[model samples]
Target: MSLISILTPEIKKAVTLLFDANIDTIEFQATRREFEGDITMVVFPLLKVIKGNPVELGNKIGTYLVENVTEVQAYNVVSGFLNIVISADYYLDFFNDVKADKQFGMVEPNPDDKAVMVEYSSPNTNKPLHLGHVRNNLLGYSVAEIIKASGKKVYKTQIINDRGIHICKSMLAWQKFGNGETPESAGLKGDKIVGNYYVKFDQAYKGEISELIATGLSEDDAKKQAPLILEAQQMLLDWEAGKPEVISLWKTMNQWVYDGFATTYENMGVDFDSYYYESNTYLLGKEVVQMGLEKGIFEKDPDGSVWIDLTEDGLDRKIVLRSDGTAVYMTQDIGTAIQRVKDFPDVGGMVYTVGNEQDYHFKVLFLILKKLGFDWSTNLFHLSYGMVDLPSGKMKSREGTVVDADDLMNEMMQTAQTISEDLGKLDGYSEDEKTTLYRTIGLGALKYYILKVDPKKRILFNPEESVDFAGNTGPFIQYTYARIQSIIRKADFDFASKTFSAGEITLHEKEKELIKVLALYPEVIQNAAVNHSPALIANYTYDLVKEYNSFYQTVPILGSDDENAKMFRVQLSKKVGETIASAFKLLGISVPNRM
Candidate 1:
């Protein structure tokens, strides 16, 4: 059992000691920064049917909690709240227990007969991934890992946004302006090549629209009068017809983009069991529309466009199929889910790691799935995260300032390499080890930066606020791990000979706090999994590492004369490093032993 579960019985006894079994419900939460202990209770919330003032009630509860609880060192009555402090002895025992159990605080999954599908990093072929996509990818990857660690059978998948008029625009620009160029021929990344064409389409169309407006055309008239969109639409129609030349071109270009994406995904250290492409599923969307229409879940307008009426659910009706029988974005998602269920009938859940802007879209999608009698539809999750913005403003492609994922990764790795060299931490490492260390440090920095914030909160990307090597960043935690490894190497101590100490050592304040935090790692993962937030785990690791560092600074460990103290610190540091590394792994980051 996890530490939290083990403590529950003790907490219950404390509560039962103070009040009549029926008077108050014991509500204990792992405390927050504003609170005083590992567990805190607010008596004011319970005193609704009682007679005493909050502080008096708190004192009575506090007194009962301390006297009745074996693990509790003391309890304080602050205003209406009872803050229960765990004994240093008890806290140290808890930490030592955590350190001894070598699973690094991971618990076995509970019995649940449901499979989960987590979809993430659905990048469009028209452009490369950017900082926004990085946030989505990291959050999605972490959430899936956490859920899987919780004992759920998770199916990790990706849906490539490969088809649409947007893609057509790129193809059209490449066809009209270029004389048949390929990534190899141009010496450019495939995604960048495709993106350049997309940008060209916008620029060319903009110039045309502006000149038309100057020639007395209204704004709407200018856009409508322009033939670029229509040409793009025609390309889409041709694509749908399986035109040999257009199909070949699309396949070739998309393959390059796919290859480029695979490289990025590899560096990010996230993998999916399967992939679904829009080109393959757009037709599936059309079939779903027909099924919905036959079942009266949707209707066709005079123009023969199919739409679902969402008014009953307080949402606007959405068009599923156009008059020309083309599928919209939502239609394709519906098809993808249906195909996925058929492919894996045992799969009981699906998660869409999408931005919050499409909140309404997923809400409608889930509701529609339920209305269609898919019971597992209730298990569908939209892991909606907020957008990533630059400090200056929203990322604009027109300004040519969109941060390319590949370029950013290279820069981070190079920066990490330079930092490692300057720190003189790589003196004894081989060239290959140095390279691997750089990858670990670079990727760790990227992951930490992305996962440090709540997924639902907007983040401002700042190059100036890069991940610090000495502060609450990935490198900082990595350095701690490296230090522990260095010390372990020097000591040449066999881990197999380690023994548990009887009773608790009189630990310093930092040691007690660090132990308590370390003991809570399993619960931290469980909570992060349930809440779909990696930031919580990230923050917890940071706090634990910070405390460990403080302890290391205050106490000597390697050659200390006190055998018990030395062994205690060594064992504690090893476990802390292990736990921190495990946490980083959940976020798709790595820690290097050398640097």
Candidate 2:
């Protein structure tokens, strides 16, 4: 049980006995640094039910805890704060019990509980995955893992936007650009080749608009009348109508993009449990719209368009079906959500990991589902996050100015290599080992740099700063893990086989502090899962590393002459390393044994 769980009822008993009153809850905080205690209880809140000075109440509770609680070694009151020092045995016992469990912080999913589905990286096939997609994938993947670690069954999914006018533009551009070129012939990944055509389509369409404008046509007229754009629009109609030739080309091109995406996902260390396609799901919500209309959840205009008026709920009217009887994006999303629950019957909740630009769209989507009388809609969450910008500024995919995900991964690896060589820490390593280490450090820097920030905040990512060996960077933490590994290697004795009695050794102040931080891992994982924030786990690992390093510098481990103390310190260091590895695994980042 947690210290809070164990102390709460006892403290309540003390309050009832001393003041003849009852209290429902206890307020606890980390003991202040200047205070000589491990945990603190705020005595001020008890004033609501009892009449007494805060300090006097605190002293009475402190005396009670010291007399009645075995874990309470001593206590002091600083104004309204009752700081309690826990026994050294409590810290030692906790370390010994959890030291050997590889999955110490993670909980196994209970079969009886409902599962959660997380959607992320729902990229359009018209372009390659870029920096924005990078953030989306990392956030979604990490959140899914964290939820699973918190004991829920999690499913990771993404809906590939394979059909749209934007896709038709790329197809038309490829068809018109002369002799047909395949991915093999173009010496490019399928997605990159397809993305090139997307950019080409935009360039050609712009050139046509400029020419028409020069001939005195209005810019808006030129844009609508651009021959290339007109052809692309017709192509979308043809694809929708199931023209054999258009369908064949669409299948071929989308397959290429899928093949390229598979490679990118593998390199990025993210995966999906299932996939959805927009082409199959786009027309799904029409029947649902009819059901909503019959149920009075929706209204139809005289023009025969359908909408849901959410003005009372602080939102405007949102169209589900147009006057032309075509479904909007919102309609597709509604159907997709329902379809997923059908696919995974046990799913009780879903988290949509999309950028903040569509915050209002999700609001309407979830509210509409609730109005439609879906029970699971109450569990829906939109994991809305801000955009990631480079120091160079915002990116436009059509203009070919976006930071490509694959290219960025390569740059990170290169950055890692440069920094690793400069640090002169690669002695006795083979070329292949160096390559693997560089990738580990590079990707670690990338994932940690992005995940370390709160999901709702915009990130200005700097590659050079992220790879630094000091400060709160990934390499720094990885280096600390590696340092622990080295200490373990030099121990010469079997630290794992030796067990020290909790009463046999008095813990050092640093050792006690380290154990306190270690005790927080389980709670950290649970909190990260609850808040849907990987930033919690990321920062917690950083803090643990900081605490371990402080303990390392102040205490003797393998160097200590006292064998019992030395063995205990080495065992503590090993546990810290294992915890680091386990935490990084949740973030989809790998750590090296030697760095």
Candidate 3:
């Protein structure tokens, strides 16, 4: 059991016995720095059941905890807070027990527990993934790992938007402008090769629209009447009708995009257990619409369109099926979601990692599902996140200004190389090792900077700022981890298997603080899983690294004259590095054994 678990009930018992009051929940927080304790109990909440002076109340409980709990060595009362100083022996015992644990603070999922499905990187095949998709993929992958660590089975998945008018636009451009150029002939990634055509289509579309407007047409009419766009629209219709030539072309182009996306996902270190293509699931929710109509969950308009009225539920009306009997995006989504449940019967919930622009859409979709009577709908969550902006501004794919995922990753590696060379940390390393370390540090900086912030808040990503080896950045923590590794390497003794017996030696203040921070790992992981936030895990890791650094600077490890103290500190350093690696793994980041 954890220290918090063992103390919660005891603290409650102390409160009950001393104040003669019943409390349902115990409020405990880390002791403030200015306070002389390791954990604190808030006395303000107890006033409702036991009215008394706040400071006096704190003193009474503080006295009770020291007398009754074996771990509690001392206590202090400040204002309405009772700070309890736990014995150093307790921390040493806890650390000793966990030092050799390879899977420390992580739990295994029980077979009986319902599995969770996380959906991310729902990219349209029209263009290669951009900066926004990086954040989405990283967030999804990390959250899935965290959920698994918290003792629930998790499945990672994505939906490919392979069929739409947008896709036809790219196809039309490639056909009209190209002399049948292929990704192989062009020596480009299939997605990037196809993505160039997407941009070409937009440029041609704008030129055609401008020409039509010059000939006395309104901008909206010009856009609608443009020959290229009309052809693309016809192509969508033909593709839906399964025209032989169009279907063949569609398959070829989508294959190129798929091959291209596979490379990107591999490089980004994200994966999916299953996938849903819009082409396969586009017609799915039509039958569901009929079910909704029969159950009165949806109403048929005079034009035969199906819609769910949610105005009374504080949302606007939303259409499920059009009057022409064609399914909308929402219909396809409904069908896709249902299909997933059928595919993975154990899945009890889903997390959709979508941008904040779709906030209203998901709200409507979740509500519609509840109205349609799906039991799993209750567990649905929309992990809405804000846009990732650059220092310059927002990105536009059609304008060819969006940051390509592959190119951005390469740029990060280059930047890392430059910075590392300047820092002169790669002495005596071979070229290949240097390359690997550069990519590791670069990607680490990128992932950590993005994941450390709250998902709902917009981020202004600066690669240079992120890679700096100080001030809560990824490379900063990575450097600290590497420093610990260097210390472990210098120690000739076996620190891995040999640690001091618990309570055998006295503890320094910094050592106690480090242990306290280490003890919070399991709780941090649990909280990160429950709230679906990688930011929690990211910041917790930063805090742990900071505490370890403080201990490293103030305390002597191998230089200690006392052999017991030297061995114990080296063992402590190894544990810190292990914990760092563990936390970084959950974020899809790797820590180098050497800098």
lDDT for every model?
Answer: 0.80, 0.95, 0.91
Q: Model 2 — which ten-residue stretch has the worst lDDT?
A: 497-506
Q: Could you tell me the TM-score of candidate 3?
A: 0.98
lDDT of 3 at 99: 88
Give candidate 3's root-mean-square deviation (CA, Å).
Answer: 1.1
lDDT of 1 by residue, 1-595 (tens): 4435545565456445555444435566665657667667666765665567888877776676577656666777777777777777676667655666767656565555778889999999988887778888888889999888767778889989898888888888899886888888999888888888888898998988999999999999999878897788888899988999989989988988898888888877888989988788877767778888899999999999998898888998889899988788788778889899999887988989999999998998998888777889988989988888876677766335688888878888888888778878777888888888888888788888878889888887654245568777888888888888877777666543555554535676767777777877877888888888899888998888888888888888787777667777787788888888888888888887776
Give me the runs in candidate 3 sitting further than 4 Å from their true place.
Answer: none
User: How many clashes would you count in candidate 1?
Assistant: 1
Question: Which residue ranges in model 1 land beyond 4 Å of their true spot?
Answer: 1-18, 23-25, 29-38, 48-69, 109-112, 210-219, 225-229, 290-296, 299-303, 323-325, 398-400, 418-432, 494-496, 503-505
- Comparing 1 with 2 on lDDT, the higher-scoring candidate is 2
On a 0 to 100 scale, what is the lDDT of residue 439 in model 1?
80
Better of 2 and 3 by lDDT: 2
Model 3 C-alpha lDDT per residue in residues 455-531, reported as the tens digit of each score: 99999999899899899999999998999889988998776666666556888889889989998999999999989
The C-alpha local distance difference test score for the whole of candidate 1 amounts to: 0.80
Clashes of 2: 0
TM-scores for all candidates: the values are: 0.90, 0.99, 0.98
Score residue 112 of candidate 1 by CA lDDT: 58
